[model samples]
Target: MTIAPRDLLRRMFDAAIAAAQPARCVPACLPEPPKGRLVVIGAGKASGAMARAVEDHWPGALSGLVVTRYGYKVPCERIEIMEAAHPVPDAAGLIAAKRIQKLVSDLTADDLVLCLISGGGSALLALPLDGVTLEDKQAVNRALLRSGATISEMNCVRRHLSAVKGGRLAAACAPAKVVTLLLSDVPGDNPMDIASGPTAADPTTCADALAILQRYAITVPRTVLEVLESGRGESVKPGDPRLAGCQTRMIATPQMALDAAAAVARAAGYPVHILSDRIEGEARDVGSVLAGIALQVAGRGQPFTAPCVLLSGGETTVTVRGSGRGGRNVEFLLSLGIALNGQPGIHAIAGDTDGVDGLEEIAGAHLGPDSLSRAWELGVKPKDRLADNDGHGFFETLGDSVVTGPTLTNVNDFRAILIER
Candidate 1:
């Protein structure tokens, strides 16, 4: 059965996402119900789905609030699903964060706090620290997003600036055994970086956040700067007693997603090459690097021969200088397309596993040997769009943009390169 390159690429992406779905991965890791009460609290793009997974399997009386990015909600009868803005915090998220703080407080040792955390929770669970207003957090968040900072660096700043992140949420539920079920989107699967470690201990300090801001030249409000300098925003450390007995389990992660995609490619009779699931650095730079590899395999057959699929998963950043539709996945694909220079027998797809790239609903885009020709026919110049950081527009005009509303799970970005011999 011969398969088209584009079809095979889409199937690989679907396999990766399907491997991380909450219903399939969350149930087995759930702990037995506590003796007192099960307070289900969570925040992230996947928290709503994770909550619903709990509701489906757990027979205990569970109730709590979970905040997810708008349009990422999953229906649940017992747990309340709250919607909030992501990548930036809004007033709705602020109110929800306060309510979550109240809900988890005053719990006894026998009670259990089932915390569902995933990517995007850092912004969705936005509760600015005292003296740092929501506007202040917003300013810093906006700057961080545009500053080309790595996810860990951006999250370090977010952790110190928030009231609920960096273990404060777990601290609020002190005496109640906290169990965090995570779907990791961050590279390395560090629990502390996932959702800024809301229910886990943080080792990063205010000084580290300050350094990240300095490294990226991201200037925040004066008050936020002062708070970081004073070390008042220091997050809960590893030895903090409040986090005692807290258990964290990574139910799904980027590596697992990549493996699933590899399985699909292998079954389709294509030898799979997994470069890495933790690749980072600038998106455009990574794209250039991958293009070199694809070319090598196609021309020289150096590392591997033809008729193979190279798969990878990880979050990549973009230093946005142009005022265009900037998405990391799109930007990466655009750069990849240009670098390949319409090299035949090579096709690729790049998309965020969560189904939203940057602030746009478009997942990502696909690139073929004729991608440049199609764009030129559509009056979309590859270099011009790349200069404007408008990869989304470039792909859209070519009718090659991949759109999957919301996957309800985030294991970060997925990239695949198929080289036909």
Candidate 2:
């Protein structure tokens, strides 16, 4: 009943994703039906699945619309599921954002608006403010993705530039109670950071968004900059009466996913070490640090003894310097492999829990002691690929890319390192 290292790593990743599935986590967090209407609306990679979960659990009548990434839709009889672009804004997303705004605009105090939110919602709920076009938002999004800006910073800019984000959606349903069930994908699980807090109050402002754009040197349309400078795009501030009745609960999180993976490792007879689930930074640098820890455990047995597994969950960024397919998980794995330098008995897997890393449909990849050697034999230079931010290309060439079409849930990134004596 012994599992190979790769199999064990894959099993651990499966366990992590299973822990955050909307079907399992959505049932318990659902609120009671309101007196008037129960309107279900949301946006994210997981919102379609979450909407289905709500449909299965609720006994009363409910209807609404939700937008998810293309290929992530789930069937629901009452709630309308729409597909849109992710990591970038599109016309379909713009239409859905407008529909969502209209759906809750006239809700009475007795009505309830249940918003299902997760990663990718920020892009899926795109509705640029006045004078800002979808193309403008898309340009800024591309810049942010390539700028290596943290999720919070990128989202802050998105929140300020959008017509429906940053509590504006909740403000639209002022009289109705907003109960937001969040599958958190950001570090610290801040409600305002999840999907740009469409149903929660925002403390960040236009000045803040301007600062982020400047800090990252992200070039945007001049009017977009003017919107921030004129405070025309200022988000709903804290203590806004519009959000007074808004209720937010984080139903799933990165820490929860990491804990589930730890359980799997322990059950498999490996001593489990749970690292910080909030780890965030440049992906390659973080990979090198984790490699150092793995090397320590494998070589000196320091920190933790051999035959142990190290688990961590958190979103990492990649500042794309080269014009190649870039994914944070693969970048991390590539860097880890380079630092390990063919260290024996140390294997690793890194992937996004949502089943896609960066803009690619590939989830992530795995690394072994022979990964470097195999790449060399295949005429692939690992260091050059890493420098070009081409982790996906490198792994695909080695036939090590992990591709899981769509998991319908997102708790952020998962990383597991197996050290055996």
Per-residue lDDT of 24-106 in model 1, one digit per residue for the tens? 99999999889999999999999999999999999869899999999999889999999999989999899889999999888
lDDT of 1 at 9: 95
Off by over 4 Å in 2: none
Once model 1 is optimally superposed onto the true structure by TM-score, how far is the C-alpha of residue 421 displaced, in angstroms?
A: 0.3
Give lDDT tens digits, candidate 2, residues 1-421: 9989999999999999999999999999999889999999999999999999999999899999999999999989999999999988899999999999999988899999999999899999999999999999999999999998999999999999998889999999989999999999999899888888888788888999999988987789998988999999999889999889999888999999999999988898999989989889999999999999999999888999999999988889999999788999999999999999999999999999999999899999999999999999988999999999999999999889888889999999999999998
Instruction: List per-prediction Cα lDDT, in the order shown.
Output: 0.93, 0.93
Best by lDDT: 2
Global lDDT of model 1: 0.93
TM-scores, all candidates, are 0.99, 0.99
